[model samples]
Target: MTTTAGSRLRALLADGELITAPGVFDGLSAALVARTGFKAGYLTGAGVAVAGYGLPDIGLLTQTEMTERARVVVEALGDVPLIADADTGYGAPMNVVRTLRAYEKAGVAAIQLEDQAFPKKCGHLPDKELISADEFTVKLTAALDARTDPDLLVIARTDARAPLGIDEAIDRANHYAEVGADVIFVEAPENLDEIERIARSVQAPLLINMVQGGLTPDTAPDKLAALGYRIAIHPGALLAPYVLHGLDALGRLGGTMPDVTAGPQGLFELVGLREWSAVGERYRDNTKDGA
Candidate 1:
């Protein structure tokens, strides 16, 4: 049998550098990130919820929709590894098995499954409930077994920190590692101390989510690396800025009713469309000449 996608991700994880995987919602965003030279990308459920349905990440999106979106992103990024968020494995142990297979076939490099209960909310969100550690362990095992490729990295995320506490979260992380999770993600560690504590406690590779205006304060990637985190995903960094800037521009244009043709050329000038068109003309001429 051929090496699996899971094994490829594990190889990247073993390299010992903090993989900066920016959250990508669509093919365009994934392509843009790959073009920017990042080695890996993350398919965030929050980004998908906001971009695809204009809804909150409150379990509104279905497993099929998320899997389909991952397929598009994986295709767009080509060989670049993608770590996809499969929230709560979309159900139970059996569900996790299916999710792993789906993501593996879609060419995702890793699949992250959280331990939140059914109809789970985002980790940063409030009023979260968690399944028992033993329950989640079974799901994690299923995820590991379901993967056809050993290289398809299985990231076990514990949302127990907020509801149960940091100690419990660490315990769950240890359990996940025992159950064959390639990486452990202890979500929503509120302070710097907890971050350092989890990094110190968890022996397996760890992944951290850096979200703006969320439970955890914003920290630099270098700072996180210093604490021993192997992967850091900033899912909302680009999306948040784009949302605010787009709204600002829309409000200004709609309120002032400015003449559309009055402003200076923007992206067209930035990209030099005329130059590109001239190059295309040359290519067309070459094709016509059979060169």
Candidate 2:
């Protein structure tokens, strides 16, 4: 049997090297990331909300909306695994079951669930409230139970760092790990000390969220690996650059545009138009021969 993307991701995590999954919000962004030879890609919720709907990440994107986006990105990313963010499992325990089934069917390799209540703000954002450890545990348990594929990672995220404390966040991380979470994410650590502490305290493989200009201090991937984090996701790393360059190009439209000489073909080729064209010709030829 062919190894699934989830199994491949699990095996990669088991081996050495910290998985650096750059965030992608759409199919083309995912294609770009995949083309660069990234082992994994993350479907960032905040990126999806902002880029797709022109909204913020205040739980505004619905479960169906995010799942549909994941499906598209997954299709674009053939063999590459997509670690998706399932915000608060889209609701309570029962809701989490459906959420898990939906995302799994969408071909995501993993689904990250946070402890924040509905209308949850970005983890880097302040004043984020969290459901109790017990309440969050129920959701994590539901997530683990809901996955038919055992290799599908169920990541439990705690947004308690700023609201409660690092101690409370670490405690929740351990609690979620104890409840059978495949990975534990202590969101938005204040500094490197807090990051090291969470990595040391949590029993599960740690996932560090490296949001640019967010609460957590940026640490090198090797340093994070030394601290024992298995995965680091830079959710806004690409979006930030993409938006900045777009604005720069738009501002200079009256003048010479950046990369304008590359032309439309270069843009289409970025998403594999030539490869798709070959596939179309082959299909037509085969159909004609059969007819």
Quality of model 1 by C-alpha lDDT: 0.82
In model 1, the Cα lDDT at residue 281 comes to 62
Q: lDDT at 79 for candidate 2?
A: 94
Candidate 1 residues lying further than 4 Å off, grouped into runs, are 1-5, 255-291
lDDT for model 2 = 0.85
Considering every candidate listed, which one attains the maximal TM-score? 2
**Colliding residue pairs in candidate 1:** 5-151, 5-152, 6-151, 6-152, 6-153, 7-150, 7-151, 7-152
> Candidate 2 lDDT, tens digit per residue, 76-120?
888999999998988889999999999999999999999998878
Return the TM-score for candidate 2, rounded to 2 decimals: 0.86
Q: Give per-model TM-scores.
A: 0.85, 0.86
* Predicted candidate 1 versus true structure: per-residue lDDT over 1-291, tens digit per residue: 555445656777778778899999999899999899898999989888877766567676789999999999999987788999999988878888888898888999999999998777768866788888889889888998887776778899999999989999999999899888888999989989899899999989899988776777777888888888999998876677776587579878875432221111221222233454466569869999995
